[model samples]
Target: MNIGIVVFPGSNCDRDCAYVASDVIGQSAQFIWHQETSLGEMDAIILPGGFSYGDYLRTGAIAHLSPIMDAVKAFAKQGGLVLGICNGFQILLESGLLPGAMLRNRGLSFRCEEVYVRVENAETPFTNQCHPGQVLKIPIAHAEGNYYTDPVTLSSLQANAQVIFRYCDADGQSTGPSNPNGSLDHIAGIRNAAGNVLGMMPHPERCAERALNNTDGFLVFQSMVASLKTQARLTAR
Candidate 1:
């Protein structure tokens, strides 16, 4: 599958995300400029981890209104796959593509560390390869990763199984320290109602290979590719 990684002015991890697909795993991938309005010949798009716009006004608040995001919104509306990581996750929330808003980390500091995450909705495209409640270790670096939603919204998300990933420990147990940002219910990642868009603070690109530590993140990508293939076949039918 051909993947496009979006790059804004402060997108430090666009290349990293592309390399994970192209170089690390040998898939076709390209860098999509932030100003570009079209998605090009792409099966998937990723808004990578970074301090976009230098987190100038607020995390993802400005970048959410970028022109290219229009195309992304349309792409996602068509049931196309889109993944947002770190600052990208912030952007997704700001763009209203994903539910909830981000708040300052409970500690109010930029955190950089590897932590365990448990898959809560493995049936979704982003986690299809993972079994429900499987634990994966991935790295995260961010300051405002605390996720918040109204009680009614949270209940809705839980009912629809949109709650995708949660912070956990090595043994796949959810706990306090495992939560890097003290997020509500330790929500580290989530998906839209359609299950085509994913927003997560953890950096899957950071662990695309086993040599890096754990290869758990690859299942997320592999599942996405598989989901696209499956969707295509279903449409072809």
Candidate 2:
């Protein structure tokens, strides 16, 4: 699948996403600047982690207003796939493309380390390669990564299998200590109601290659590619 990595000012991970998509995943990829209104022929789009606009306002508050978001929104509405990682997750929240908001890490400090996340739902495009309850070791870097949502929204997400990943121990058990950010319900990742958009706080691109010490992140990209191919086949019928 053709992928487009969105880049905004202060977006440090755009290149990482591109490199993973092109070099690691062996897929066609390109960088889409925030000001550009067109996404061209991208089959999927990724909003990589970074302090867009230097996080001048609240995280994701300003970047949500970018000109390209309109296109991204339209694309997602039409069943296009979109993945937002870390600060990109914050942007998706601010854009209303995903539910919930991020809060300061419970410790009131930044966190930069690897954490284990269990695959709560393996049906979504982003996690289809994982087994149910499988654990993935991925790194997270952020200060305000605590994800929160009202009870009503959380219930709906649970009912619809939208909660895709949760912080967990190496054995795939969710526990308080395993939750690095103290996110509500240990949520590390979630998909939209329609299941086409995903927003997660972990940085998958950081460990997508063997050189990164772990290649578990590659499964996420592989899942997307497989999903896209299946979609293409169904559409062609």
Candidate 3:
């Protein structure tokens, strides 16, 4: 599978994402500058974690207006896979590609640590390699990772199984201490209703290698590659 990792001016993790996709996952990967108007022939798009545009007017507020995001939205409309991590998740929310908004961490501090997120719905393209209720220990680093949405929309997301990952303890229990950013309902990640787009606060690319002593995050990228392979086979048939 070919993956495109978007790079904004302040994007620090684009290369990290590319490394995981290409070296770790054995998939072709390329960097897509934010100003580029075309996505080319990529099968998957990743908005890697970073403080885009210095996170000036709220995280991702300015980056969403870049030329490439329009292409991303269109690609997602066509059922293409899109994954956003950390500040990328902020951009997705700012672009309105995924519902909800990010607020400052409840503690009013930047957090950087390994956190556990339980797979809530593993049937989607982004989480297909994970089983329901599987706990993944991924690292998260951000200040505005707190996720919030209206009550009605939250209920709708829950009803539709759009809630894909939730903050959880090592034992897979959602608890107050387990939520690093105090996101609503312990939401660590979520997919769009179409299930092709996913936005999450964790930095899976950081922990995807066995050398890092944690490979739990590898499943997320593996799942995307698997989904693309499945799509290719179905198309060939």
Q: Provide the global lDDT of candidate 1 against the true structure.
A: 0.91
Structural similarity to truth (TM-score) of each candidate: 0.97, 0.99, 0.99
Candidate 3: give the clashing pairs.
none
Give the winner by lDDT.
Answer: 3
Count residue pairs with overlapping backbones in model 1.
0
- lDDT by residue (49-91, candidate 2, tens digit) is 9999889879999999999999999999999999999999999
Worst 10 residues of 1 by lDDT: 18-27
User: What lDDT score is found at residue 137 in candidate 1?
Assistant: 88
Cα lDDT computed for each candidate against the true fold: 0.91, 0.94, 0.95
Indicate the residue-level lDDT of 28 in model 1.
96
Error of 2 at 72 (Å): 0.2
Tens-place lDDT per residue, model 3, 195-225, is: 9999999999999998999998899999999
In angstroms, give how far residue 148 of model 3 lies from its true place.
Answer: 0.5
Better of 1 and 2 by lDDT: 2
